[model samples]
Target chain A: MAKKNAWWLWAAAILTYLFLYLPLVIVVVFSFNDSRLNAEWVGFTLDWYRKLFHNEKMLTAAGNSLMIGVVSSLASTVLGTLAGIALHKYKLRFLPFLVLTPIAIPELLMGVSLVIFFVIVNQLLGILELGLITIILSHIAFCVGFVAIVVRARMQGMDESLVEAARDLGATPFQAFRLVTLPVIMPGIIAGALMAFTLSIDDFVITFFTAGVGAATLPLEIYSMIKIAVTPEVNAVSSLLMLLTLVLIVIASRVSPSALRANG
Target chain B: MTLQQRIGKWVLSWPPLVYMVLFFLVPTLIMVVAAFRYPGDYGGLAPMYSVEDGKVVWDLTLENFQRLTEDALYFDLFIKSAGYALATTLACILMAYPLAWLIARSPKRYRDLMLLLVILPFWSNFLIRIYAWMIILGPQSAFTRAVNWLVTGLGFEPIQLLFTPFAVIVGMVYVHLPFMVLPLYANLEKHDMALLDAAQDLGANAWQRFWRVTWPLSLPGVFAGSALVFIPALGMFAIPDILGGTDSIMIGNLIKQQILDTRDWPFGSVLSIMLTGGVLLIAALGAAVARGGRKRG
Candidate 1:
């Protein structure tokens, strides 16, 4: 009876894993199918990839996504690292609430609120239009929480004695931080930066509200395409994006495994 | 605190503090105020004050909130969204339990790898995940054809699978299963094997040991996972928009239309505030229950 129960558990677990992976596998497999329709598995071909390269809109959107990702990640990394250290070191009341609330709220709420806020600000000050700049700012607003979470977890696991000893050995605060603390958390910072970049590139809902016109990221572009019709080109681009994410995860795990766990 | 220590604290905390206030807190406050303000003739909010007959007149009303109560359509939509979220959470629990338990019971060396496998798909682009479902549930896909064939063989009319509530629910579960699995795995990994052993020694069967021990012990994990899944699933617009038909609109879709299509910012803000209130109430209730459970335990 026990053996039978174990077998049932194993079978259920395996089926769940299949449910998770089967859709993704079909997507990848269908990306290379020669037929335009996604129903049947046709002979293998890379025409969709070729068409994607030639498509001006997709390329421009990809460029925009990369540019926005770089700027947002860099800006959020600095602020998030500072917030992380402060959260771990000090007993501040309001900072944690401000930093973490964005992570807890629904993205739609944030997106719509930002849209209202941007319009009001534009009306009052005659600045801050809804474009790439607004989208980047929104990305940073959300990404900071995730980066701070990873960095704070790293700070929690650090040896406090090392920083204290450096201070006691006639090192100034700046010197101790620069020499001791910074090096120790370097992996966490790098991991946080990568995570921020991935998030910025992949953000859709917030970007949808904030991106008024003339600025289309990869996700916004993909959404328009999906809305119009299904095509193998979508599968082609998705496969490539999955490849990019897998590579980033590999590097992040190599740099700091705990960062992944902290996110989970 | 010393002056230097105070200055150090200021240096580290002030940047994020000011940024979050400007970007996050202020925007949320503005949305709250927007809910009461009049909609602009064009798209945005109307002017707060207008000079009428040499006097300042404030243009604010409770019409948006009134609109919500005036019609049962919005109320029905909210209930439908909540129902979908609840169903998604329940389905996630059924699927996540065995997988989470399997990972927890695996040998220590393989646990990390197993957990990573579960999270890997989630890290992919969100739209891509939804699109994957579009393929699987598409009318032309083999899965749909197979279902239709079975239906016809049973003497029932063939049915549409794509762009239905079922498709929307499947997408929600696929997207959120990891949220359930992770917390449950974290909780189950810490269970004491000796308790199970003791139950067995006392003539308890495997089913009894699980029902009497594991189920009760994992309630906190269940609650945590449910909250994580329920809140996001409730607010999800993309899945329903892409996979659901015209009749399957949720509150998120309605909110999107009021803001983007109709240019009714005031009404959009009202809907958003309601959603935000619902989320907060749920969070507070969950926290209270967890605390109450802890006291009793």
Candidate 2:
């Protein structure tokens, strides 16, 4: 009876996997569809990929996304690591609530509120307006919460006595952290940074509000393209974006499974 | 602690704390304030004070809240969004549970691979993922063609699948299934099977063992997965915007229009606050259930 039940579950599992991967696979496969229309596959060709490479706007948007992803992830990693370390080591009472608040709230609300704040600030203080800087700032704001949570989860599982041993051996506080604590938590930090990078690069709604006319990320550009029509070029671009994300997830899984697990 | 150590800790925390305050907390507070206030003559949020007779006059009002109640549209959208979210959560739980259970029962080496298969697409661009569904469910796509072929002799017209409520629900389940599965798998994987074996030895059948033991143990995962799915699904704009028709408008679409099209900042803020309040209520209820489950366990 157990074996019979297990067979049905295995069949359901296979169907579920198919359901998850089917859309993604179709997107990838159609990127090389020779016909411009997506009605039926005419033949396989690489013209769409070539067109994507030559499309200046698409390339520029991809570059902007990369630059913003790099800057936001780096900044978020630094602040998030520091916050995670401080919260873990010092046990700041209100820090967890403060850090987790962004995670708990809906992303649409977060995006709207941040846009409102930026508009207010731009009016009050003449220094800033919606642009690449605002987009990066918004990305950093949301990405930091995930990074801090993942790093802190890693720190909670760490052996505390390693840092103590380093301190007892006449190492300075900074030295203890550098030599012992840093290496132990480096996987989490790296995982967090990569996760930040992935979230920033793939963000659409927040970047849509924060990114004004001058700056458009890949997702924003894709949204416009998708709004106009469904083209093979869009499929090609999506396949490439999915490939980049796949690479990041592979590296993240290698670093720490718990980081991805902590995300949920 | 010494003063120097205290100062050092403060210094260490200042970056993230200050950044969050300036960005997240302050903006959220502004949203709350904006919800209570009114929009200016043009497009921005109205200032709390206006200069009248060379003096700052208070201009606060509860008009936005009042309007929210008076307009049945927002209330209807909220209820519709909740209904969609609830349906999506139920579908996800049904779809994810079997997959998660299979992965849990699979051999150890392939288990991680199966789990990764579930979560891999979650890292991709969310908008693009929804767009992928458009192609799959489009009238011209193979899925529709196959469905139409299967029912050829029935003398029924081909179904329009895209830009429909069913399509929106499908998109929601596709996007959120991994979220549902991951937490469920995490909970199910750590189960102590010895209890199951003991129950079986005592003549409890599979159904009894599962209901009395497995069901109670997995309540936390169910709660976690439902919270994750339901909250995001409620506030999702992209899925509905891409896959839903005008008849399927949800609160998120209304909020998006308020911000982008109508430029009604106060109304947008009001909707934002209401959505946030609803999500918090759900989370608090989930926590209560979790606490009750723990006591029972």
Candidate 3:
């Protein structure tokens, strides 16, 4: 009876997997279709990919995405690594709440609140505005939490004896940390940085609010194109974006396998 | 603690703390205050105070909150958003259970590979995932034509699938399914196989063994997964905006419209506060139920 029931479970699981992959398969398959319509496949061609390469707007958006991803990921990684260390080492109260609440709440709330905050700041200080800087700041604000979560999980799994032994060998506290703790958690930090970059590049809702008129990221650009009309060019760009994400995930998993699990 | 140790702790904690305070905490507080302020003539917010006859007069009112209550449309929209979220959560659980259970039951060597497959698509761009559905559900797609064929053969009007509430729900489920699967798999992987053996030995059949041994233990996972899916679904604007019809707009869309299209900052803040309150309440309720389950067990 148990064996008989397992058959249905296997079938259901297979169907669920198919459901997850089918739409993505369609997107990729139709990107190569010779015709503009997404309805039916035509003869294969690389025209969409060629068009995407020459599209100035798409190129600029991709460049902005890369710049924002690099800067924000670097900033968030440093702050979040400290946060993770503090969270693991200390019994403090407010730090944990500050680090985790942003992750817990709905992202739209964050986006709208940041909009109001930026406007108010600009009115008072006349220095801040909704642009690349604002978008980068918002990305850091959210990306920090994810990095902290990954790094904290790494710290939890670290062996304390190495640091202790280094300290006992007459290494100063800073030196002990530099020599022992840093090396142990370096993979976590790299994983966190990569994760932050992926998130910053892929973010849409917050960027939609915080982005200035001219500072369109890849996602913002994609949103505008799809809103106007669906075309194989969008499909070609999406396939490339998906390919980039896959590569990042592969590298992240190689560096720290548990980082992916910590994401949940 | 030594002075150096104190300084070390401060160095490690203060940067993130200050950054979060300035960016996350302050912005949230500003939104809370913005909820009570009046909208400016052009956009954003009205000045908080103006000196009239050399006196400081404050500019704050409850008009935004009141506006929400005056319209039955807003109330119904909240209910509808909640209904959609609830449906999405249920669908995710139904679809996630078998997959999660299968992964959990698989051999240890293959488990990581299976889990990776589930999370891979989730790592891709959010808009791309929604766009994929647009292709699948477009009028000329074979999937839509097959469904319409069945509907018209049954003497019913052929229905459009794209830009409908059904598309919204399907998009919600598609985007959030991995959230449900991960937690459920984590919970299910820890179950002891010997317990099932004991139940079987005691004459409990397969169904009883599952119900008595597996289902009760998985409630925490179910609750966690439900919260994960429900809260995001409730506040989602993009999924609805891209796939939903005009009538399928959720509270998130309304808030977005207020801020972006209508330039009603105060009302947008008001709606955001309401959403925050709702999310907190649900989280608290889930915690209480989980604690109650623990005590009873």
lDDT of each residue in A1-264, candidate 2, tens digit only: 123346778888899999988898888889999987777889999999999999999999999999999999999999999888888878676667777787776789888998899989999987569988999999999988888978888899899999889989999877887898889999899999998998899899889888877888899999999888899899999998888887887778788877776663
Candidate 2 ranges beyond 4 A from true positions: A1-5, A254-264, B150-152, B198-205
True contacts kept of each: 0.76, 0.74, 0.77
Candidates sorted on lDDT, descending: 3, 1, 2
Residue lDDT tens for model 2, B175-260: 99998998899899888888888898999998899899887899899999999999999999988988998988788989989987
Write model 1 residue lDDT over B255-295, tens digit each, in one string: 89888889899999999989988889888877888787778
Model 1 achieves a DockQ score of: 0.68
Q: lDDT at A239 for candidate 3?
A: 95
In order of DockQ, best first, we have 3, 1, 2
lDDT of each: 0.92, 0.88, 0.93
User: Using Cα atoms with residue i matched to residue i, what is each candidate's TM-score against the true structure?
Assistant: 0.98, 0.96, 0.98
Clashing pairs in 1: none
Off by over 4 Å in 1: A1-5, B52-55
Please give the distance, in angstroms, between residue B102's alpha carbon in candidate 1 and its true position after superposition. 0.7
TM-score of 2: 0.96
Q: List the residue pairs that clash in candidate 3.
A: none
In terms of DockQ, the best-performing candidate is 3
Interface RMSD (Cα, Å) for model 3: 1.9
Best candidate, lDDT: 3
Predicted complex 2: DockQ = 0.67
